[model samples]
Target: MLSIVSIGLVGLPVNAQPLYPTPDPDVFYTPPAELAALKPGDVVRARKIDTGMYVGTEGWQVAFRSTNSMSKPVMGVTTVLLPIGVKNPPLVSYQALINSLGTQCNPSRSLFNGELQDAAGAMLPIGRGWAVSLPDYLGPTSAYGAARLSGMMTLDSVRAVQKVAELGLANSPVALAGYSGGGMATSWAAALQPTYAPDLKLTAAVAGGIPADLEEMALSLGFAPHPGFGLAFAAAMGLEREYPEKLPISDQLNENGLWFREFTHDACRRFLLFHGAFRNAEQMAASKSLMDSPVAREVLRQNSLRHFDGIPSVPVFMWQGRFDELTFFPPVAEVADRYCRAGARLEFRPYEIAEHMTTAVAGFADAWNYVEARFRGEPAPTTC
Candidate 1:
């Protein structure tokens, strides 16, 4: 269990803000006893889908018990889309970039209501007769940027799909793919699989334009003209949800900052990016350095995917744009090198004509082809 103790106002006087908003107890967050008793990837409930989530696909939206960042039990929902006329199809968990601060923006919910933003990307695998599982990787609370929690939920979603007798994915080959915020989920799931869910036996994992180092990205986007400043601030709020005691954010934020923080709780990623672009993070928190506190440093380090030493045992394909506006290329390159040095089979590619958005679009073909090849039992090509 992760213990997070608040480091009360140190040489600073400020009003204490509410650390966390109280969520409704009757809804999605209320975990069943079966969920807590089950292991990380155990199914809590399986129900037939009646929603238009995946318009062309017909499958069940399963609710499964998953482990959180604190190793506690939590519930996650996943839409399992099986190929229309195929049997025993290969499984792929398509982690969409749902970078919202609200639960309503989750891909699972969007799929049900037909509001998914990445339907085009999801169509690639669904069109190829591959079974795709779209997991609400951020889980019920919309813990955006909480990579560990995302990864755990993702892995558990796959387990839930496989366990559902109606899905018939028992012996199917599994692959993973995502980009941007979704990439963070894919990367963490891949890295943690070897230890956390070794039985997953993931064939290949593809991540593009990944924000591997959250701390670096947070600091990098702290200044003007960069929409990342808002996104970074959102991440800090997300982290506070996971480690409230450690990030007593309410105490540090000024009155204006407090309002901004609360207002963003239900804001979408698009709204956040342009909401307060170019604002300095220090000004928002009234701190000289966001990482000044020991608690802050530890929380940031713990959440950073790049700092973790786990090397994915499965073949990994990582693609980054030559110039990504949101996540700079240096840290992405550094992570690729780190994985390669850790003796993992990794193919790291940088696209020439790709910006952040274009890289995801340009790399989709390659990413899908890579996963397709893996499902076909072909050996993954490695740059290492």
Candidate 2:
């Protein structure tokens, strides 16, 4: 039911269809051969970021085709930054703590033009002579809590960015790093890489404040004192977008819940805090509780990191703040232990920080050392 218009711009085969809605889903479906034949790291498009005071750093907004959680073809965008003088440098796929439903907040947009608060901070890697790939990861739809999809996008972004000749990263070593929501993507990507994108050479990964188990996260944070209630809600809302058939969320949500859903469409972290007051899924769902819903239970189980098989083939550095207000330490620790048992070369670091916000900064130096060593071909220490 899409209307066609005559706007001639070149590269047209007389009968070719042009996307009118800017991300008309039809565009993603087209040229199946191109998407299917996409090598793990094929570069689709790259455009330099022209704004902000980015000294000695050249940034690009890249878009590439990657598989979604369901293994369906999807288009993903990332922000790629390179140091002016560095050539063929090591790459770090830094997943930002983007726990927002708004599409504008994704790194491809917000961080691309250096408009968000995290923009300057993300540039730190470029300063280290490491080319950085900051993927929107969540896809064009902004599937905020679709962990596996985000992970796939992360790995694929690394692949696509490496192929960019201008970046000179054709054979560059790769590392993955993120905290909190970003950690969810990092951990999932690491665990999935062995089977999902085994062709890529991943040197190391660092995940801090990881929400390893979503079910536990819901139970522990969907109440008072824990501010993660909003995050949990956002996750559910996001998952619904990705797995609409499996989740069928609208049928389960009450009037108030539906209102919340509409309100969250363009909401970001700052707005989430106030909405977090609901504290419980029962307050949102018509079923009275997420535990009482079979669909919710199944979705939570499937998305958890522990449900997966082999861990990363490369070294992994995981850290958690013992008193993290958002991601409780115990579940994160337990999952790390599970990764260790699965024979992953894991170094689990626990800090005594009182909360989640400062934990990211506290663990920064250690993460840097770990990844830098991996880039230098140094062996990773293991607690296994």
Candidate 3:
């Protein structure tokens, strides 16, 4: 069990933001005691939701059976949006960069919050008369940085959609796309698809601002509290949910770390950025460089796209900034090259003039074109 402690203001800012209902107590999001009986992608339950905020779109929140990082049976929730007039549309699983530790920040909840960027981003695909699925791929606990769990949730989300007859997406051609945290999920789904869910008709994947090495991103932080530390520490806290024994995050925290963990459990992306702006991982950890320890190395390796053995069976289009301050460019480039050499059909683009956030705008058009072509059954381009 993870322990909770108190931290005074000197440790970290105590922004006690109100928490929305977490998964366990929330009736709609809760899973049954044992999921072992169900197969991955099995629709556990589903309920229609209002998409009135987005004109001419119908939506539903689906809870589907999936596997956790440990390959244990688990349930995941995804929000599916259908264009009001489209028939037999192709499916696009858009993994939102849900870089938060709170269940309230999951796409299922955020998709309705027009204020959030990803909710608006989902609109582009829906406007194209495509079925869009925004999965809370982080699992029931909002396991933020657990990529394998996210990947399985992503692929299984596609399956859940196909099984829902009312959605009319039976066996529809599928394409996946995401940026940053979502990119990690998209890449992991690509790498794990062949063996994990090869039955689906996966066409292509678009991964931008990819963080290929989980450990690199986690350990690259300095001792000082900075703007980017929130994302990193959130990831560390997120991973703790998946591997509590191996990663004693709650147990290892000093006063500030304890405060961070508590505040983040109920916080969202915006709060994380503002609160962690002046803090770093060293402040939370008892052993300053604990992320470099052997246990952390092994756990991070298992979740990282760079260390994965297999590549996606479908074509891939990857884009990144030349100098990304957050998810660095070199690691992403290396993953692209490794995939190319492994006989994977890939197209890699680097926005030479862009930075982390700038790459999103600079690379959007090309990524859109790639997804469009794949949906049209056009041949995939290659830079390998």
Alpha-carbon local distance difference test for all models: 0.75, 0.72, 0.78
Q: Show the lowest summed lDDT stretch of 10 residues, model 2.
A: 1-10
Q: Candidate 3, which segments miss by more than 4 Å at Cα?
A: 1-21, 24-26
**Model 1, stretches more than 4 Å misplaced?**
1-29, 51-55, 223-225, 279-283
Per-candidate TM vs. native? 0.90, 0.86, 0.92
What tens-digit string does per-residue lDDT give for candidate 3 at 1-384? 011111121233233332222554568887877667999999888889998788888998888999988778988899999998889988899999788887778888876654256677667888788889999988887887788888999999989988988888987888999988898899899889999998877988998888777777655555666676776777766777787656655655767777767777866788888877867655676655453456667778888788888888899999998878777888888888899898998999988855676787777678878999988889998998
Top candidate by TM-score: 3
TM-score of 1: 0.90
Candidate 2 residue-wise lDDT, 1-384, digit = tens: 000000111222333221111232424213345666775556666776664576787777777888876777877878887887787888999998788777666776666434355566566777778988888888766777778888888988988887777777889899999888889899889988988888888999998988766766665553243445665666666776676656555555567766776777777676776777545555565553444455555667677776665578889999999987667788778788888887889999999996886998888789988999998999999977
Q: Write the per-residue lDDT of candidate 1 for residues 1-384, one digit (tens) a residue.
A: 011112233554443444343453434446686667788787777776664545667777788888877777888888787867798988999998787777656775676444567867876888898889989898767777688898888888988889988889988888888998889899889999989998887889999988777666655553344546667667766776765555666577766777788878876677777885766554565554454467665666676777888889989999998777676677778888888888988888888854688888888888888888888888878787
Q: What are the per-model C-alpha RMSD values against the true structure?
A: 3.6, 9.0, 5.0
> TM-score: which is higher, 2 or 3?
3
Point out the higher-scoring one by TM-score: 1 or 3: 3
Predicted candidate 1: what Cα RMSD to the true structure?
A: 3.6
Assess candidate 3 and give its lDDT: 0.78
lDDT pick, better of 1 and 2: 1
Q: Is candidate 1 or candidate 2 better by TM-score?
A: 1
